[model samples]
Each structure stands twice: as structure tokens, then as C-alpha cells.
Target: MSLAAPSETAPTTDSKVVVITGTSSGMGLAAAVAAAQAGWRTVATLRDPSRADALREAAVDAGVELDIRRLDVTDEAAATALVDAVIADYGHLDAVINNAGAGHLGTLENETVADVREVMEVNFFGVLHLSKAALPHLRASSGRLITVSSVGGVIGQPFNEAYCAAKFAVEGYMESLAPVAAALGVTVSVVEPGAVATEFVNNINLDRDAEVAAAGAYAPTLRAYLERTAAQFLNGAQTPAEAARTVLEALTADTPAFRLQTSDWARDFTAIKLTDVDGSAVLGLTGTWIG
Candidate 1:
């Protein structure tokens, strides 16, 4: 991770400060570099700065400097402190990208309630802590607060009970807060990406034979779902930089949309729920994945 020198310690006139989380890999990493290249005083944050090699390399290759910081979004205190430090360092805080999240791969019956809670803590509560900490500063600067949500947030899928539930909460929260935040001069938006290749698929733990064998009565359905999922990833998944582009759009757009889908496929997939008069459309579609 590159540290700023005394002369470059403060933000230059051309640099707009933006903090991005989960940048050790995937979209977060790409978004951080994109932000810096786009002339932002980018703060590339991760739970452990030791894993920042990829992020650092990307920044260097892009010929941009980044302020790498440690931020565990799950910690409310740490979120506040990080925001405070950013404000103190740069003299003014701008935007904050809440991209730190984890994926869970268990159905309710197969996993404990604690498993679900842990998912919520990272995917939902982590966003909450960071967003809450940054709202005031964002309001003052009239800056953007973007989140990296998923298509799972809109339409539910098999074996993603905990993951979808957390994303649903995130989308619901941001959708509701958009107008209120707008009233106070802060732009709030959620970028939903579908089948983002290795961006999230890599984070999921899915050992096919091991999982299906232990799945008990749900074995057959789980196997079908797994097979279908693997095919989707191997065949049509998008790159992390592709998804990160959407995040950058949200952060930099003049009048950013409240809900943004990364690709046309994502828009159409989520459109199923948008036009769904009844829940049957969504359920009918996802039902085929396991059946």
C-alpha cells in the first residue's frame, strides 16, 4: 500500500475524496483504482491491509496514488473513526462506497440461526454502520453514498436464503433513504450486479460433492441448484471491473439513479419483480433452478 508524502498528504484541488471498502479483490479493487484514475482522493479500505497487494498493484499500473486504510465495516466504532480520520486528513469528507460484504450458501434448515445472523452482520449491518457514519459528512458535501447490492436483493434464489435476506434489507434501506437523503443534499443509491463472475462467486464456499452429500433430504434440489449455478458462472459471469464501472457511475453521476443495475441482463432479471403483481412470477422463475 502506498502512503502519501507530507507534500501530498492533503487533497489537491483536482482530487475528490472517496472511500471504498472490500478492495482486496473483485469490484472493490477495481472501483478504487477507477476512482483514483478518475481523479478522486481514493481511500482504499479493507479488513486487513495485508491483502492490499492487488489493490496497490492496480493503483500503480493505473499511475494513481491511493490512501490505503484499514476498515472493518462490521465495526460501528471503526466505521465512525475511519470517516472521522478521512475528514481530518482531507479537511472535508466526500463520498463513501459501501462495498464490503460476504456471501453465504446455506438454506435455512441446513444452517443454524447463528449462520443467518452472521450473514446479516456483514452484508446488512456492515453497510448500515458505514452508511450511518458517513451520512453527516456526505450531507455537508452534497456527495454520493453508493452501495454494491446484488440482483439477489430483488429476486430470491435457491440456497441463498441468508444472502438474499441481507441484500433485500440493504436495498430496502437505501430505497427508502434516497428521498430523505436527497432532502438533505446527499445522494443515496444502490448498484445491483447479477452473476458478476468471480466478484462474488469466488467468495462463496461450494464444494459440490461435499455439500450435496451433507444436504440430506435437500440433496437432489441442492445438486440441481449447484449445477445450474456453476454453469452460469463458468458460462456467462461478468468481470469484476465490469461491475465496478456501475459503482463508479453511481459515485460520479450528477443525478444518480436510486436503483442501478450493472448490466441489461441484471435490469431484465430484476424487472421480473418490478412488474410482478403477485409473488408467483419470482417464485415460478427461481423454482426452475432447483426443480
Candidate 2:
């Protein structure tokens, strides 16, 4: 199905214009639909519009419309142009959801520096590019800036060093910017989700066999960690829709929080840091995964 052309006419309403990145599938797709249902003029963007069939189908199935556009967060020019086009077309921009991210797995030694840089480019610098581009428009509207971080941001896990590093950077970047943005009336928030069953997990760019083979003495532990992670997905995982609701809540809350976890499990998991300042609690838990 072909997506509607990017709208040039400004939508009429007390239109809360929200731009969500990575809407080809998963939480981004769900968030775009949910935001539209909640009466926002939702601009759902993805790197490839050809891959947006699922998003379009879902929106049609739910009887909501999305202003779908092509946006590759990794391309600085495209990122800037997309935001400029959104404001130019819609006349106002209220919220920007930095949901465009890629997942990585494997130890630092197993993955190449190129691999680490690729993940960071999408997961960390992508947020920076889009957020920086949208800040002026957001400031003009006293808008919301929400980025979808992971529970791994606060607590590291085995074989997720690069992914966790990027998320941790996202959390830090937003946390540091939140107070300053608040001074200008833009509320910044980070949503941390645990084990959501989405393409985000299925599409992780990892070669487990290759990683395990390269591990040398760490092979057994790497295999065990992979098995345990698979079990976690089977036993406890949120739906993309459930995760999207958290994003929606963050966008529309009367007084939005600086950080939000999508599930009670996520909250409890992240609480390890707050409950224990030494960081031993999370470290000890992660250690068990390797053993």
C-alpha cells in the first residue's frame, strides 16, 4: 500500500503535532497510531517508507490516520529537513519522540569498533541529531521531547555492552538536558522498557555463533547468557502496544516525569540502582547470567 504524500496543508484543530521516529514497525508504529487516536496530528517517520506497509495497515485497521514521512535519523541533513518540513507543513510542532534505534548484542571484544560505531550512530547520535534539530521548534511551542531508552541504560547486562552504552548515553544526554529544557518550558522524558516482544528483539544484528566462537574461554558463559535471555522473552515480555502506551502517557501527561519505565518489572529492575548506590545489586544480578 502506498502512503499518502506528505501533507502540505496545515491541519486545523488545536493540533498537537507530534513527530515519532522509527515507525516502520514495533513501538514506533504503535505510538504513531495511539497518538493519532488521542487527537494529535501524528507524523510517523521511518528510514524507508517502502517498509511502512505494516504501519499503514495498522492505522487503517484502527481507523486512524498518520502523516507518514521518510526520515533517516542517521542522516543529519534528512533529519533536519524532516523536522523543518513538519513544522512548515503543520504550522506547529509540539512533541518529538526519539524512537529510532538499532539493537546490538555481543561482548566488546567479539564486536568490531565499526559495529559499535554503527549502533551508536543509530541509537545515540540519531537521538542527538533529531533532538537538536527539533529543539527550536519544540521551544517555540513549549513542547515535549521523549526518547525511548532501555532498562539496560541503567543496568548493564552480559553481551549488550555496546547497546547498553548507547542507551546509557541517551539517558545521560536527556537527563542533563532536562533541567535546562524545563527552564524553557520543554519537558524531557526517557521511557525505559523491559523485554518487549517486538522486531527490536527479533531484528537485533548479532551473530551468536560467531560471537561464541570468538569468545575463547567465554564461550560457555556467552551461550548460557543467550539461552537465559531467550527464556526471559518467553516468560516475561510486553507487547509493542503496551510499550507504546507508555510513550503516549509521557507525551500527554499534565506534568510529565523525567523518566518512566513501561512495566512494573522495568520499574523494579531499574530500581536496583536507586535502591543500592554501590551498584553491586545490579552487578551481582548480571554476574549470575555469565555464571
Candidate 3:
């Protein structure tokens, strides 16, 4: 990937600095460019800087520049070092966007313990590592801690046991931390998006046929769920740009909401749990997908 430098006008002392992870593609890449265009000194990090072509092209097209860096959020040392380096370069770390995550699609019977662990490592523990590394700097700057969660975080879906588990952990972690972070002058928020039209589906770490063959009694339900999910994606899925805009809103809002959804569909889907503690609303709705 080409590493394009920022415009000739380098970031000034007063320019706000924001770090976003997993900007190789999808919403993270869009958010990085949007943030830069919005006058932020954007530090866009990816697991492999070599995969930053799309992000660099988008930044160039937007007539903005990103301080692209290599960061694998799973590495605690790397996460801490990146935060330290950003603070040293920008004088203050203003915000951290934990957009780095992976998707898993399989039941416990089809997925090994290691598979579950890998999903949690990227989707859940990655957030924890980056947040812990940046918390002190964020407190010092009254910064924002925004994460791109999924509708799955709020409502568990069929065949997404591991992914939903990880996202649920993230929502719980952020919701619980919001008040404490507020007391320390740092804002914490989670952005949940539903069926985004991105490479996420293509990038899911699962072999559908293999999973179905191994599912035994669960094969029919798993197949039905997958077919329905594909239909939903085809019918109407929010664009990555739309989701990125929500991330920007969460980052720039004066009084940011603790939990935000990118689209009305997501909000309505998540609202079921809030309105019905018994979870019958969401459970019944999801059951239709498997049937």
C-alpha cells in the first residue's frame, strides 16, 4: 500500500489528534478520511500498513491526509507504544476509535475453542487493550473513546455465537465504563450498525459448507439463518460511509450518547431489548429468520 503524506500544511499545534484502528477498509477507512476532512489530525492505523492502499486513496480523493501507522490492537505492547508515540507526536491524544474487529459465523459445535478465542481477541480484548493504553491520555485531554460495535452486540443472532458474545462484552464494557470515564473527563460510547454493506460478509472467518456439514442436527437452522441474512443484506444494508458518519457524530458530539446505532433499523432492533426485559420481542423476531 502506498503511504501518502498529509497535505503540505502539516498539522498545527492546535489541531485535534484522533487515532482510528483497522483502517485498511470498510467503515474504519471511511471514518479516517472523514475525520481528516473534518480538520482532525487523523492517525489511521492498520494491522499491516501494506494494506493501506484503499485508505490512502480515499484520503487523497478527499483532499486530506492521514498519519497512517501500523498497529495490531491485539498486541498490548504495540497498542501502548502507538498511543505513546501519538501523544509524543501530537502533544495530546484527543480520541481513540476502536474499529478493529473480526467476525465469526458458527455454532459452538462447529467452532473450536480456539476459534471462539480468536474472535474475542480481536473484537473484545482488542478494545480493552487499546482503551487501557489510551485512557490516561484521554483523561488528560477530555477525549472520546468510541467503538464500532454491531447490532449483534445488542441482539444475539443464530450462528453468530462467538461474534455476538464478543460484541456483547464490548457493549457491556463500554456502558459500564461510561459513567466512570465521564467522572474522569473522558467520554465513552459504542456505535452499533446493522447489516452494513461492506466487505465484512466476505471477510467472515468461516467455511459455510464445512460448518453446515459438521453441524449435524443444527444444519437446517444454520442454513436457513444464513439464507435469510443474505436476503437481508441484499434487501437493504447501510453503506460503510453512513456508518462512518455515525462514528464521526459520536466523536464530535458535545454530549455524546453512551450507546449509538448507525441506522434506524439498528435502533429499532436494539430497542426491543430495552422495551421488553423478557427478550421475547427480539427472540421471536430472530426465530423467524431460522424458520
Candidate 4:
């Protein structure tokens, strides 16, 4: 990924090149469209490009074109190859949105460690692989690196041990990298969103009845957690488009913050954990989620 020199470029309200993953749906799709609309040379990527119909339709409707490609973020080789290709074709990569992840709903007692590893491979390592592969190019362009994390990253939730652990890993990794990356002329930011209206839940592919049947002593607590979580998503979820706005801001801002929350609710939810010294506040708040 050696380059001639750093240059001001592509999507951040410029013709700068930006690569976004998981754009087949959700915030990824919306952010890809918004970046294109904002005058970026946007590369929208997904695990399977064949499922890009909705992304294509959205582009056509928005009257903005995008370079859609296949990118399984979990594959380090695939990530590096696409990045090299983007650099060769576009000349520079000014920003990246790491948003490719599947949903997982399980507790350690009910699921094997293999399940947790699979979740980490996508949610945590996926971001790591793509971001690592793109670092040289981003440094060459003094670019922005943003990831769409969840509030779960900040607050551990019941029945979501694997997902929360992975996201927490992402947040910690990025937080530690921010200062080091900043010195290298790259901006790193993590955007945390609360529950959003998207296919994220359905994408988990969980069979509630089967999971409950296998829960043994933990079935009742799991049921309560599931019910509460469903009601929250049903009654108080933000739109993917709404969440995408924060990601866009992180892309183009002259001086973006190291951390951002998609909504006020997300801000408040994470605040409890941030300000909690003894973990009592976070525990008290998350405790009611299952009760």
C-alpha cells in the first residue's frame, strides 16, 4: 500500500474515496448513499454482492451512483485485495466505515465457546482485519476511520454475552488506537448506536423456542430479557437512516470527536457506564432490563 504522497481527496464533501462495508442493508446502505450524495467516490461493499439489489435501487432513487463490490470483512486477504484494488483504481482512500457484523443472542451457559468465537470473528475481528488492511492507505490520505458499534459495547446486557463482548473489544481496540493513529495523521472514531430499526435482529437467525427449551434453569430470565428487548426495539428504535447521519458526520467533520453516540438516548445510555466508578450505576440500570 505504498503511495506517492499524502493528498487531500474523495468523499468527505470532496471527490475523496470512501469504502463502506455491509452496505446490502441497514446503516451501511444508508451511509453509502449519503456519502455518494455528499460527493464522495463511494465504494459500497457486502459479503455477497448478489444481494445488492436494495443498495442499487436506493442509489438509483437517490440519483447517486456507487461502486458496489463484494467484501467479506472477516477475510483478511479479501480485505487487503479490495483495498489494494481501490487504491489502484481510485488513487486514494480518504475514509472507511466498518459496519459488517451479524447479530447474536445467547448466554455462555446455553451456547458453546465456538458460538462466541464466531461472533468475534465478524463483529470484532472483521473490523480489525479491514481497518488493518486499510491503514496504510488511510495514512497516505490522512483519512477517517469510523465503526458502527452498539451501546452494548459500553453496557453488558443479559442474553447477549457474545455480541457485547465482541463490540466491547472493538471499542477498546479503537480507543487505544485513536491516539496512535492520530499521530500518523489518521482520524479514528467509534459511533455507538442504541437499538435501531433494521434487519439486525432477524439476521441473528435465532430460534426462540429452541433456545428457550435449552436454557434449563436460565430459561425464565432469558425469556424476560427477550421480551423486554423486543418491546424496546418495537417502541423505541431509531431508523437506520437516522443512525447513518452520525457516521457521515464522522466521515466529513474537520475535527471529529474520538467517540460519538447516534442519538440522545444512546448518549444517555452510555453515560451511566462512563460515569460509573464502582459499576453500580451500570449494573442498576441494566438490571431492570431483565426484571
Candidate 5:
């Protein structure tokens, strides 16, 4: 997959211009194929094109071509250049899905400063860079900026500080960006999925020995907690295809929500937000209640 500038032609009724990142596997690949099937000229960008052969084959099997390109989301210069190239080739960008992300499984204390930095670099800064680069074309087409965030974006879970921090940052950034994009006729959405059985978790970077050696004093508790979370993650999870549909809906629907949570657990968590804080006080003894 060599990099080339986009063709200088306008998009026709039969095609839509879309750029999807992290399409080598999981939700990103699913969204890319779905968009292509929906009559879009899909550009599937991955860290390494060679690593995306399976995805490329799958897209072809579906009768849609995924123009694979080498893209590292952290490379702002390349991202900016690619955005301009896409606009030039297709005349406009219909949507930009920031789906390229990686997960790290460990405790904050056990992970080195370097490890935390690497996590933020890909999960947070990558989305930021790509979103900034894609804005002009998205603005021009009145396009949508959809992010594949996680349930961690809202809730704080055990032993996932770095990953959670990155997601939290993504949520905050998208919230600020959405209102501004709305004024430009562009919509921004963050898909905060819960426990999707994507390759994301299965392929988590868990270099425990290295991580532990880096934090000798703090390793034991962090390691144990991470092990527990890993077990829980493996026990119950939704399929990536379902998550793909949720992302697709957010993309093409007439009225899309700013947030979409894709699990029963997520639905319950959303409902729980309505409970009054005073309800907790009622469970305490009368002496403990604040009259």
C-alpha cells in the first residue's frame, strides 16, 4: 500500500468519501466494510498495510474495495496530508471515524511513565490529531466525526487508569468539539461501548514481567487487580459485529445521538444515573441522615 494523492474528481451519487482508521481488525475493519457496503468510497487506514491483508480480503469479499494505506495516527503531518488528499480525490469527506486505538491492561502504579505516555499517544493524541486534520473537509461536506471510545470514557473501572484516562480525555475532547462541529453542520459522536469482544482486549499489551520490574514496590497489587479484570473481560463480552452496527447507525441515521453505549450493562449504568443521591442516605441509620 503505497501512499498516493487522491484523484481529482468529485464524488457521484453512487459513492461516498469516507476515511476510517485502525481498520486492520476489530471494530474499525467492521465499520469500514459496513460503510463501503452502504455505497461509500472507503479509505481504510492502518498502521501497516501488510498487517491488514485479512481485512482487505474481507472487504473485497463483500464487493467493496478498501483502499488500504499506511497510517500511524500519531503522525500529525501525515494525517493532515492524507485529509487533504482525500478531499482532492473525492471532492469531499462524508465522515471521519477515529477508530484506531490500542488498549493497555495494568494498574497506574505498575505502568511506567513511558508506558502511560505510549498509551496516551495512541488512544488520546492519535484521535486528537486525526480529528484536527479532518475538520476542514468534514466541515466542507457537513460530515460526521465519529469516535470509537469505550465505556471507560464515562465510568472509572478498577486497574485501568491509563486506558481510562485516555478514554476520559477523548470524551471531554469530543464533548467540546461536538458543539462547535454542530454549528458547522457537522455532527460529532462518541460511541462509548461496553465490553465488546473485539480483538482490542484479546490483544491488549500485557508485558507483565517488564511492567512489574519497572515498578518493584507497586507491582503485586496492580498485577493481581489486572488479572481479575482480565478474567472478567474474557467471561462476558459483546461481538464486534453488533458494535459495528451501532457505529453504522450513528453514521447514517437522520438523528444520531452524541453517545451510544452497546451493552446491557451499559444500559443499566445509564439508567442508574437518574437515581437521587438522597436515596443512599435513606439506607443509613436515622442518626446518620442529614435532615
Candidate 6:
């Protein structure tokens, strides 16, 4: 992985230093672009340094430079070192975005423990390590911590047990950090998103076909549900650029919201507090308790 220095023309700003992880693609890339476009000094870190061409191009197109680095979120020591380096150079850190995560699809029974652990390590532990490293800088600068969670973190979805668990854990962690962060003049927000047309789903690690085979029986049911949901969200699914803008707004708002639901489904989920419903009420629909 090769680290690319920010271009000479890269946009510069004071008191707006940001470090974003998993910036090689998707939301992270989009967020970095927005920050750079807005003239914020951005440290964009991707797992593979060689793959930062797109980010650099985006920054160049925006007439700004995005300082690029190679960062593997799962590596604790590396995360710490990178945080130190950013603080050393920038003199202060304004925000940290933990967007390096992947998904797994299959039944809990069918998925191996190792698979579940791996999911947690990246989605949950990665945030933990990165946040821990950045807390001090955040305290000094009165910065914000924004994490990319999922609607799955808000509502349980089929064949997403491990993924949901990791998201839920993130929510809990953020909630616990709220007060501590607040006392130090820092804020935290979790961006919960519904399905966006990203390559994220395509990258799911489903090594066992038997689980997929079992899930195949419900393919029609799932397909119908997904189609209906997608149709409703596809139009509203904010592009990566749009989502990044929202994140930036959240970070700099005079009074930032603790949770940001990017789409209608996420908004509805948050509005209703789905966890308040009982199993019987959930089981009984339209005066029919089929289950």
C-alpha cells in the first residue's frame, strides 16, 4: 500500500482537520470528497494505499488535495500510530469517521463462530479501537465522532444476525460514550442507512452454499419484500456525495443530533421505537396470530 501526499492545490482549512477510514470506496470516499470540497483538511485512509487513485481524482476534480494513507482498521497498533501521526501533523483533529465495515449473510446456526467473530472485529471492534485512539484529540479540539451504522442496527433483518449484532453493539457503545464525549465538548452521532446501491452487499462472505440453499426456499418471500422495500428507498437513497454532505452538516451543526437516519425506513424505525413492541403484538397482525 502506497501513501499519497496531499496535492499542492489541496484545499486547506484551520480547525477542520478530519480523519476518515475505509476511504478507498463508497460512503467513506464520498465523505472525504465532501470534506475536501468544503475546504476541510482531510486525512483519507484506505486499507490498500495503491487503490487511492479514485479518491485523489475526486479531490483533484474538486480542486483540492486529499492526503491519503494506508490503514487497516483491524490492526490496533496501526490505528493508534496513524492517529498519532495525524495529530502530529495537523496539530489537532476535528472529526473521525469509522466507516470501514463489511457484511455477512446467512442463518446464525449456519454461520461459524469464526465468521461471526470476524464480522464483530471489523464492524464493532474497529470502531472501538479507532475511537479510543482519537478520543484525546477529539477532546482537545471539541471534535465530533461519526460512525456509519445500518438500519440493520436499528431493526433485525433476515439472515443478518451477526451483522445486526455488530450494529447493535455499535449503537450501545455510542450511547455509552455520549455523556463522556459531551463533558469533554465532543459529540457523537451514528448514521443509520437503509439499502443504497453500493457494492457492500455484493461483497458479503457467504462461503457455505448450504445456508444459501436453505435460504433459497424463502427466496420468493425475501425477494418480494426486498423489491417492495427497495422501490420505496431507491429513489430516496441518498448518493454517497449526498450522504457525505449530511455527515459534514451533522459534525458542524450548532446542535448535532445523536442519531441520523438517512432514509424513510430508518426514520420510521427511529420514530416508532420498534423494540417497545412485544412478541405477541408482533406475531399478531390484522387480528390474526398465525405464528
Q: Write the per-residue lDDT of candidate 6 for residues 1-291, one digit (tens) a residue.
A: 327455533334464888899887778888888877776788888887777788887777787777888888999999999888887776788899888898877555555899899999999999998999999989988888999898778666665779999999999999888888999899999988776666565567333444434655655444444455446456666667766666777666788788887766668755544654664432342123111
Worst 10 residues of 5 by lDDT: 282-291
What does candidate 1's lDDT look like per residue over 1-291, in tens digits?
234322124445356789898988988988988888787898889997677777777877878888888888888999999888888777777898999999889888899999999999999999999899888888888989999999999998999999999999999999999999999999999999988766466677667899899999999999999999888878877898998899989988888899999999899999999999889999999999998
> Positional deviation of 105 in candidate 4, in angstroms?
0.7
RMSD of each: 2.2, 2.2, 1.9, 4.8, 5.8, 3.7
Tell me, by lDDT, which candidate is best: 2
What are the per-residue Cα lDDT tens digits for candidate 3 across 182-246?
A: 99999999999999888888888557787677789998998898888888999989889998999
Candidate 5 residue 26 C-alpha distance from true site, Å:
0.6
In candidate 2, stretches whose alpha carbon ends up further than 4 angstroms from where it belongs are 1-14
Give residue 109's error in model 1 in angstroms.
0.9
lDDT of 1: 0.87
Look at candidate 3 and give me any clashing residue pairs.
none
Pairwise lDDT winner, candidates 2 and 6: 2
Candidate 3 backbone overlaps, count: 0
lDDT of 3 at 169: 97
Which residue pairs collide, candidate 5? none
Model 2: per-residue Cα lDDT at residue 262: 98
- Looking at model 3, residue 137 earns an lDDT score of 92
**How many pairs in model 5 have backbone atoms within 3 A of each other, for residues 3 or more apart or on separate chains, i.e. clashes?**
0
Cα lDDT, all candidates: 0.87, 0.89, 0.88, 0.88, 0.77, 0.76
TM-score of each: 0.95, 0.95, 0.95, 0.94, 0.84, 0.85
